[model samples]
Target chain A: MIETKNLRFSYNGMEVLKGVDFKGEKGEFIGILGPNGAGKTTFLRCLAGILDCRGVFVRGKPLNEYSPRDLARIVAYVPQRVEPSFLTVFDTVLLGRRPYMGLTPSDSDIKTVEEALKRLGIEHLSLKRTNEISGGELQKVSIARALAQEPQILLMDEPTNNLDLRSQLEVMRLARELANDGKTVVTVMHDVNLALRFAKRFLFMKDGKKMADGGLEVLNERLFEEVYGVKVEIGEIGGVLVVVPI
Target chain B: MPMDYEAYTRRKAFIGLILFLSLLVVSLFSLSSGPYHVPLREVLGILFGGGTKDDRLVVLSIRLPRIVAGILVGASMGIAGAVLQGYLRNPLATPFTMGVSNGSMFGASLAIILGAGYSLNSGQVFLNNPYAVVLFAFLGAISATLVILALARLRGLSPEAIVLAGVAMSSLYVALTTLVQYFANEVQLSAMIYWSFGNLARATWRENAIMGVSFILVFFYFILKRWDLNASTLGDDIAKSVGVNIERERLVGTLLSAFITSVTVAFVGVIGFIGLIAPHSMRLIAGGDYRSLIPLSALAGALLLVSADTMARLIVSPMNLPVGVITSFLGAPTFIYLLVKMEGRR
Candidate 1:
């Protein structure tokens, strides 16, 4: 579980998160939807403890009190884009276990990495250099790396970017399964339908403030118009609610 | 798609064995090489204390110390370069990039010009008070590294900032060294110039022992931090996400690298190219894993420098060319070849 109250962050004297408040629980799939400059990434980074902020808590403990290693044990974050390096897919995934590993990787560490790769269906490319992989495969590799952490909370920024339709569905399905298995999943997404289909809890942000929070009941054409300045028709497709922007 | 971890381990072991053997051959060749050629048989004989006095003197007193100096200095530079490149995540990072060489050169030049008047009780001023030059060199290097670190701290420890600070500090030290050179007398100027040429000929048994001990200590320290280095190469943000204390690790790693480089430079002037080329060469052979890359770079560096120093001795025979000169000639071409080969691969 994670909680934040009055969390404020600033850069160059400009406030990005203006006294924002949030609460998340285990086994919950949460999607954050926002327009440009809605402070979505900054909020996620604060929750992941990547940026220093006040009034952020994880499992009833203040985020600042946790050491980096201790925080890594409970939370994993995948950034928007990772630069390709000389590391192999296996090694990149294995780096996720760095907090738990010794000078050399233990047998269990390697096993965990292998399992993460398998879970992401990327075991076939484990030995390939990260630079030699395709964009979609690299995205999965980054996810696999975060999965190797085996954390209670997962934070992903634009996880579906560069992925094909099938891969996107597969990744969303995987996130659903992970939440069903009792892991907290927090993702910042631009695809409204994908978020609606996969995520059970929705949070809409506007101008660095939380505009709405809850289930499907919180979403409406009026809220969409206010947040995104776009008129949208909400309809059901295959018994799933879909938002169509006009 | 499972990895054959056993096979991978065996292959790395094989490569390590071959490198160790190559280093052995080069070491033996270096032992047997000099202005006065001591035969391989005599070199071996002297090792077990059964050679003639002249052969023993040549092999043990002169060539042995020089060979050890080359190995220590080369090994330190190689590992230091590897650590810097990995920690900074920059291929161009080398030991001298932190201003260690320039700082040591300034210190050595200062001692050469100023301490020429200082005498010792033994009446052998140069040998008896060698510590004056080495101490100054060590202080100079440490102070310059500290200044670079301070600037880096002020600038958020960004790679570009650290590099810029180091370059500025390096220019400052070099300018100060030139000032010393301008004010030097004839003997002091030549002595200072010879010191900067980076010859192992000045190696003494005591100095070799000191360097050997430092090399072993620093090598083990780096090996212990190999995992951190691997995580660091992924960039600082990811390194932090993976639980690495990026700032602490970067500071400590850079300081250790500068320390090793300073000690080597203090002892053996300013050897060029070994630090810059050794890690790149090893990365070409091995992958980017720091565990294998660090030790492999050490062996490769020791091999390259020993062989180059041998050529420096034999190129014009009795009049020895500075080993530094030979290294630049050999290293630059090899580096260019690697770059072209890498580009071709892409």
Candidate 2:
């Protein structure tokens, strides 16, 4: 489980996260929804221990108590855009085993990378240079790299930012599958409808504070207007919550 | 399964590196086999067992030490380049860009012009003491690193800031070196000029031994930290998430590479472009995996310099041209070719 209490962060005297409390249990698929500049990235960074914050706790332990390697073992993070200059897909995915391997990677480490590539359906691109591949392929390769780490919790920051609709749906489906396989997933999403379709819980943020944190049923038109400051049409479609802009 | 793509690639790279190293050895043997006519058997005998006194003196004292120096210096500079390029995620970054070459040249030239070695009671001038040259060179490199770091801090540690500061410091150091040369005596001026062009003729057995040991030590140090270096290329935030202590790793890597560059420059003058070009070539062939790229770059670098040095000697006969001139002559066209190829591919 990962948890944060009274988390506050400020940059250049402007607060980005203000006294936020959040938690995620094992195998939970939590989708974070926010307008632009709502501190979603900052929250994820703080959770991954990439940013210094006022209060953050992971598995009932203080964030500072865990070393970088230990945190990496527990939580794997896939950034939005991973622009590797000249690495091959195989090598980039193999980097996920860095925390486990020493100078040379072991056969088991190689196995893990192979499994990740297979899981992401990028086995054919193992030898392709990362820079030469398409953006969508790179996105999957990045996720494969995170999966190779074998972390209990995964954090993705706008994973589908540059991807087209098909790639976005593919990534979303993969995230859902990862959650179904007993890995906790916390993803930042800009598409409210997509988040409502797949995520079991929703975290809505506005002006550096949590506006609402609950199931899709709790996300009504009033909450959307309050958080996003725009009228949104909320309805049920085939037993799934559908959120659309008015 | 599927030929284990990673293993296959690594095996191919390893074999290619071995082939390159063997070629380098052949070049080293050929270096000694010019108009003087040292037989291959005799060269081999001299290398392993003790040969005739004349053969031993010629091969061991004159050629072998220089060849060893070339290999070590080449490998050091090459690996330094690979590390820098990997760290900055830019193909153009090398130790020279960090002002290491210019600063070391300035320090050595100052020592020469001021007669620091003569005042220290050394029969040979030009700061012949290895320790003194290494110390001064290290100081110069470290100062440049600090200045670059200070500039980078101003811009929140962007690669552009560090690169811009490095370029500024390199220009400043070059200007200072030229100033020192302008005021130098005839002998000091010639010495500075020759040193700037670079040579392996001063490679004594003692110097070769020191360089060999230092190169091995630093090479292994980087090999151990290869993962951190790879992570760093992904940027600081991503690196941190992947369990890397970015600042510490960067500090260690930069210091070790600076030390290697300083040592090489102190002994061999500024052998331009090997550090900058060799790693880029290796990256083109082997991709950006440091575990493979670093070792391959070292071998490729050794092969290139040894061959270039051989050409420098044989091309001009007794009037051996500077190795640096030959390297630049070869490296520039290859670099341009690569640039064109990259553009064409894009």
Taking the true A–B contacts (Cα pairs closer than 8 Å), what share appears in each candidate? Answer: 0.44, 0.72
Q: What are the TM values for chain B, all candidates?
A: 0.92, 0.89
Candidate 1, position B191, lDDT = 68
Scored on chain A only, each candidate's TM-score is 0.98, 0.96
Classified by CAPRI criteria, candidate 1 counts as medium
* Residue pairs clashing, model 1: none
Worst 10 residues of 1 chain A by lDDT: A80-89
For model 2 the local lDDT of residue B96 reads 87
Please report how far candidate 2 places residue B239 from its true position, in Å: 2.4
lDDT leader? 1
Q: Which candidate is the best by DockQ?
A: 2
Model 1, span B164-238: residue lDDT tens:
778888999999999998998766766677677888877798888888887898899989888778778776767
Colliding pairs, model 2: none
Cα displacement (Å) at residue A85, model 1? 2.0
